[model samples]
Target: MDSFDEAVDSVREAIDRGDNVAVVSDPYGGRDAVADEAEEYTLGVERISFSSVAEADGYEMSFGGQVCVVEGCRYLYTRRVDGFAPVKSFLQTVVESDATFVTTWNSYAWSYAAQATEVDDIFDDVRVPSLSSAEIAELLSSDYDISEFLTDYEEVTADESPSLRERLPFERLRFGIEEASDNVFEKISGMSRGNPGVARAVFESRSWQTDDEPLDLSYDDAFALYVVVSKERVSRDVLRRVVSPDSLETSLRKLSDSGVVGFDGDEVVLRPQQFADAVSYLERRRLVW
Candidate 1:
């Protein structure tokens, strides 16, 4: 496996050579990190976030020589294709002109566009992978020293907290949780499916204990919430099929109480991170089918 720097450097080389790169990363994980790293390669970097076609239009008048870092392209219209035209037009400008286009995308958005549009055909797309264990160690050892914690310690302080890393915080979370128990990390690894965004999401929302007292929760209730999240915007009809009719409403209510899920009369929804974490949690517990 290429070291993180090696992988990043390869992309940096392309941008310096005036080649546009479409960086696809799992949601909320690597795109921003890649964009941040772009500054090291280019003399000047111009960052822009466009919500719609109208916004994309203004891009032409903005700047000239700097390498333009474009983000929120996935926000064109949620599906990443329906609203890609305007941005595509703007990007065409980047192509014909001298400016370099360093674009970023959410994995899901890129996946959809790949199937439905010429997005994949039009650009050089690269998917960033999660760092390896040794890579993680090599990367974070200098910034953190967790050796003392292998044996019991008084308590972890903010300075020593593994959560403090601004980038790849979730990767360190794996090592930290593993320090508590190897078995827990194994489940987290499998649950994340090696995706950093998914892994970090699991870490942030995990509330396995509070003062050594587990929250008042049952496997079934947690399972109910998991189903809700995995399905994405679960409806009452679908909820009835997964949950028993007798306890359907009660189970739903309990899941909502868990704070990981939100339910309006219309549907049950999970925040992006919560959704990924719940999927991992349920899979680890063997609660998913």
Candidate 2:
């Protein structure tokens, strides 16, 4: 399962145990899936749109057992500054109510909303920002062997349009690195990570390597490499390939249960680091003591 799937599943499981939850996100990003999964998993769900939040106060008061799942929302609409007042008001209902909350968004908007809301202590906020280079370096320090994670990296493809990178944050370089790491493992035995695009361009350069070594790189690998070399985030597919491998699915699921890497659908993402001293913790996990 990707990061989205995992989050949905976790909330569903929580609801089954009779806990109410608030799953929030944009409309396009799969609100229905949560409803379906909640029903399928027997977790009673109630979906609330932000536009309906003012009306929801009574609903929450009246509904006793169902899990209140809110989706298709932004903390505030991007076009209007006036949007914040409604959002804050709606969030206040959630804060005052006895409900668990979950929200999703694109990294940029999420960060902005998070800053505007400043209600970190009130809600158990979970931030699933696209990975960055610093995170990859941090993961390497952990005892987490990435052989499994590498495969999910293969399923995702990079956008051919370079303009995407310009729109996304530089911190998202982790997705590119994870994708590239997969490519390096599958193709070039001694791939260099010095420059992001170097390894990928090597294959695309249309030169000596393909003619001499005849490396059998698939489109999946190509996409992985492209993101890596370009220093871009891996799209959804690649992240799916890494954590949801056929053989290791069960183990990965268990790891997910232990909250190591989170899943939204099939994409795998790391949790926010809890410890202040990540570098040392990573080193210990790597057994580099």
Whole-model lDDT, model 1: 0.55
What digit string (tens of lDDT, one per residue) describes model 2 on residues 1-289?
2445666666656665544444433212334455556555645445444332233223333344345655434423332335466556556766666655444333334434556665444444333222123222223325334455354333222332323432445422433333344343322212212121222233234221332322233334322222211111222343334323343445445434533335555444433221111112333343111
lDDT of 1 at 192: 47
Which predicted model would earn the best TM-score?
1
Q: Which stretches in model 1 have alpha-carbon errors above 4 Å?
A: 1-3, 51-61, 78-82, 133-181, 207-289
lDDT of each: 0.55, 0.37
Each candidate: how many clashes? Answer: 0, 32
**Each candidate: RMSD:** 9.6, 18.4
lDDT of 1 by residue, 127-212 (tens): 78764433333332343453543222222222333343224456545534543433333333334444455545544554222222
Clashes of 2: 32
Quote the positional error of residue 67 for candidate 2 in Å: 1.3
